[model samples]
Target: MKSKLTTTGSRLNPSQRPAICLGMPLYNQTRFLPQALDSLLAQTYGDFNLFVSDDSTEAGPGQIVNSYAAKDQRIVYHRNEYRRGLIDNWRNCFELAGEMDYFAWVGDHDAWHPRWLESMVQILNTCESVVLVYSQNVNIDNNGGILDKKIKPGISTLGMDNTRRPLVVCRQGQGFGNMVYGLVRARALRQAGVFPRVMWPDVILCIKLALIGDIHQVEEKLWFRRRTDRFSMPRQKRALFASYRPWYFKLPWPLVNAWMLTRSPPALAGSETGPQRNLRFNLAAVYFQRWWSKFGGGSWIGSPHEWRRGKATWIRKLKKFRTAVELKSK
Candidate 1:
């Protein structure tokens, strides 16, 4: 049977919008989709709407979504006629948020604890100034078995001033970008411009959020991320930008990200102030310096072995920077 979604032809009024929106971008991960949907549907918080945007070439994912939507009206499924790549699918899911108060991007391959939505909603409700709230994560294998790896917690811009927040985010290399999976204020997410067209757009979005409002992290391990190292830069570039030109792969992605950070904030009605604009420029400079140290210094390019070696050096610097930030904050 071919899977399909009955598109809601009419847009809901602002008053009719659900209080919370979970935008889930799905790909061809049919084997894990059931677990992901089960985890989400089991959330104790029942007031939210789950928008699943499928970009899979096969019917498997859509079938899974259809099965779940059959039982849960809260699940609003939308299937693209053609493949839209990863980032575009994410954008499609985000578009489903409309005017919801709180919004979150749920990874189709990831599983959340039953209290994930409940805990995040409580934090967002309590912390009026917080634009995002996330819990700690536990790494899991493809089989859902726990992986024995040390997982670092994401940066929580709790007491930090908005001006200095982006600096912490810019330097919090690698895995810190996972904060995008955390629940975020719909207004703030819109102000951050959702996802930019960059290599690590999630990192850029996090920096933008840092500039707008506070970010909180719950201590409990509520997110279970399926870990796999089968990463291909070219494949990711195609998936992210929906581009396949040879020159596109050669472009300095982090440098491009730096330039994006300098641009004026998204043109959403009430956006960044002059000072925030200046701060974003300063953060861009920080990003440029890091990019140079990684690429210009000949540290991040060369053989695969050299790449691993260069990454280790960057990780060391990240730890040092994080330690300094923690000490200064104290």
Candidate 2:
């Protein structure tokens, strides 16, 4: 777990800060590591440290990190005792950021604009209520230029602080929450209790952070996220998680959401407008699809509605037709 830096009763004084730490976890990412590192080294903000924990099966990863560390003193290299998979590697990255005033995550395949860190830290210094800062981002290809400008989504929950609801529902993101768009306050990560055991690590963390305070949108596109065939959350894991009820609401959200829920004010609980209803409803749809697949195409009762062949039963007939087509294709 990541701990907050304390001086007085609150978070550490920002004026005394030396450098922001940028942390990343790498696993067999030799092809993309160099570009990611170069992006960081090319940052207009010079006062930052890059910590990399290598979990690659081969020495190629360590050698790449070492090559950078040799040339740039800001880069520090560490290898795991054994292989820590995705979640642990990221967990340890936040934990190792104990001394940093602010930090952000960088994936081996992700790149950033030269002004990324400089803009986020400046926003952090000015906004006390903003625990998380994110901006528009461009999605990039392997060569590290803009692939598409449209992948950047809005930070949909930005002004939720003004609403009077225990629950808040959001559509797709508008600005941030693009995985790598965040440059988070280190204290807030500790207070938020970091990422939990969720299928979407960045979304869960960003949601928790939003619950505590507000988000600052920089408007400029600084963060760049990578998308490819191999990089994804497994469909099975996503489907399984979608099937569960909003267990967080049963108790405090600490078990399911982050510590930010329990410690912060009551605003984030989703009781205000229709946020709570939308959450469960959205999750239900995701789960419903999974259940259909698991039960072999439809309800396990085996089309009891088929007995009543009426005009309203049109959906059932369409489903039967689809199933027949699938069987034929096999």
Predicted candidate 2 versus true structure: per-residue lDDT over 69-183, tens digit per residue:
9999998888988766666677777777667778887888878889988777776766566677776777777666667445644543344443321133222333324633477
Q: Give the lDDT of residue 188 in candidate 2.
A: 73
Candidate 1 structure quality by residue, lDDT tens digits, 1-330:
011212223444446544899999988888788889999988987778999998887889889899889999999999888877777788889897677889999988889999988888777765666888888899999988999987764666666666766687677644545688989998888878888766777878887887778777777899999975555554565677544433543677667778788877547435757776678788998887766544432233433443566454466677699999999999
Angstrom error at residue 249, model 2: 18
TM-score, model 2 to reference: 0.66
Candidates in order, TM-scores: namely 0.81, 0.66
Report RMSD (Å) for each prediction in the order shown. 11.5, 9.7
Identify the leading candidate in terms of TM-score: 1
Residue 230, candidate 2: alpha-carbon lDDT: 40
For model 2, the stretches where C-alpha displacement exceeds 4 angstroms are 1-18, 156-181, 230-330
Task: Provide the lDDT at 54 for model 1.
Answer: 83
- Candidate 1 backbone clash number: 0
Backbone atom clashes (below 3 Å) for every candidate: 0, 16
What is the overall TM-score of model 1 with all chains considered together? Answer: 0.81
